[model samples]
Target: MENNLKNRREFLKEMSVFAGATTFLASIPWMKAFAGSDGSAMAPSDRVRIGVVGVGDRGRALLMNMQQIENVEIIAVCDNYEPNYKRAIELTAGKAKAFYDHREMLEMKDLDGVIVATPLHEHAHVVVDFLKAGIHVFCEKSMARTLEDSKWMVDVQKETGKILQIGHQRLFNPVYLNALDRVRAGEIGQITQVRAYWHRNSNWRRAVPSPELERKINWRLYTEYSAGLMTELASHQVQVANWFLDKIPTRVMGSGSICYWNDGREVYDHVALVYDYDNGVKCLYDSMIANKHYGLEEQIQGDKGTIEPEINRIYSENPPAAPGIRQLLHSIEKGIFETIPIGGASWVPETAVPYRGQIIAPYDNNDTFLQLVGYVQAIRNGKPWKNLLREGYHATVAALLGLQAMDTNQILEWPAEYVMEKDL
Candidate 1:
């Protein structure tokens, strides 16, 4: 018990430093920051207690990930819907308190942090409350549904020094990190273009048991609540694009329509977008709910090679020779770039696989779990992850800008407000 009291004091001291004042929040020992360094076994007294708001599909997934982390305790779970609320409580094995309203959950006073996994449109409101309470927040992308709301979240995070980690799981994926390292090391040569796509065959709707639940259930199809494919899916690829390019787009143009799924959905079922960076790099992106052929991919192309982190492959435009005497012997055996003509009829075109690639790293990269662990660690240490908030905001604004272009039928200029955060 004495150890618990000392832990509480240390936690408050850390938090007071964050708030720029010594006034501590409720001194519940459960709110103590984990005393262990990275990967250390945290006793219950040393665990960072967290509250989760909006236990929907994504929220529940995040909750499950949190349960896998031994150093974190989910002291509270919040959801407006009864089914989600019950499922989340069951997942917690009834160890957590349940609240229909997130605000009530915030009143618990023992929470060191909160995860805001509400719909994109609902992010700003829920996240702002957590920030105001001096609670660290992990908000899922695309930061918020609107530009104003996204900016508000960023601004509040700046005002309060609490850790604000937006969920862009690709930022933590080892495949992506290795690819990025290679790119930075000029393994892919000069990056010239990037192409990404997300394809699905479903209408992206929920089966509403009652007509009244239509708007609530299929919020992604509604313009008021969601931006459909762009915000829901493209947000991931767009973020990866920006991170690789190391800059935000200077301008954006796009077109989207519900040409296939004309089921009274306000948002588009297909979208084609192009983002132009000031450095003359272009990112080509497209998505469709009418086709599942490609599934989803982000292809980064450069002069010497191409990287597809999705498949953990890097294809060299020119495969270098094997080192030492074997390479010299192989070169002596065959003429460079000369095709042996005996394999197929001259009139018939025979296709042999042209490009060869090697897997740089072969680990089952669990991106979502990495993202959660990052948030927990940052919160436990009382520090924010560097530039994480800006990554989410940049992508959200880019998507919004593209939507404007699609709506206006003209290229839209990127907003200067984003320039404050984006180094570009």
Candidate 2:
């Protein structure tokens, strides 16, 4: 019995020592995946190798964010424009290999994922190519320049077993996340309407040395390269409305004009849209480059209260306080000699009173970085990504519907074919 007991004690001690050593080694960044005794290099199962396409302004920002995430490496970058390609290399500290063509970059065996930030028109081709190559994709918002392109991207995404994360950063924003939680918790009961607007005062003009450069740098001003205020600015609010309502708009109508900044651009400088959902909820969105007055980015008006997701303000209307005390005080101060009706007889029923309710402050984080982190983590873990192709397509379609309604001077019903065809 004593001999058997001694052997059991020895076995337990050895196991404990082995477990401790394994954990200690795992805690070390350099030895994160190894059993230390063998002195072999650790291979990370969670690290995502990323390639960047269209290293323009937004693409460079995405690349910078990706650089800050752990377990992710930027292996390659591609851009058609030479200036953008050079800028991307500078931004990445020249750590990634540069390519003039995206197809070549997609062929890099080391890339586990890619971020597509090309011009609005090129989004579909780039995204579809990367998806079909079995690489996860993070495409910028307004998924494509046209509805057909948006649909095609969705179909390709379904066919490919790769993650497709759209760049609607608000979907991952902490403020929106908390606001969604509060709305779902019934803090603001039955959201019936939403008001959203973005206003900016600018010339809405671009400086281009040549016509070729004009097409490149001033893409937002031309209809051929962009969808004007609807896709560029209103898409964000439309997405917020859809997220909060948990449904796509059933119908859309709006009007837009180039009343200001008449620089011969093909798109509008101001737009207003109304989205009607099947649930009877409505979202009002507007974007104007001629003014800066604004109420809020997005305000959800519910039965009980209102929630401003962008400002992180939530509150219910406060009930008026009784005016009897104020009237009594006024009567006393009047000394009864004036015969002024200052008491309850003269009191007004509706008086403003300070009411305090739940107020949540907005969250502070590099949302761009957080979004990239989620994308990289999902890619490495083989998990589903948020803001998939369908969401992007729907948002784009909604924006385009507003644009069409504006141009035609008619209320546009959501087209049946809008939801049907694939590829733009």
Candidate 1 deviant stretches above 4 angstroms: 1-38, 43-45, 321-356, 420-424
Candidate 2 C-alpha RMSD relative to the actual structure:
12.7
lDDT: worst 10-residue window of model 2: 31-40
Candidate 1: RMSD over Cα atoms? 9.6
lDDT against the true structure, per candidate, is 0.79, 0.73
Give per-candidate clash totals: 0, 5
Question: TM-scores of all models?
Answer: 0.83, 0.78
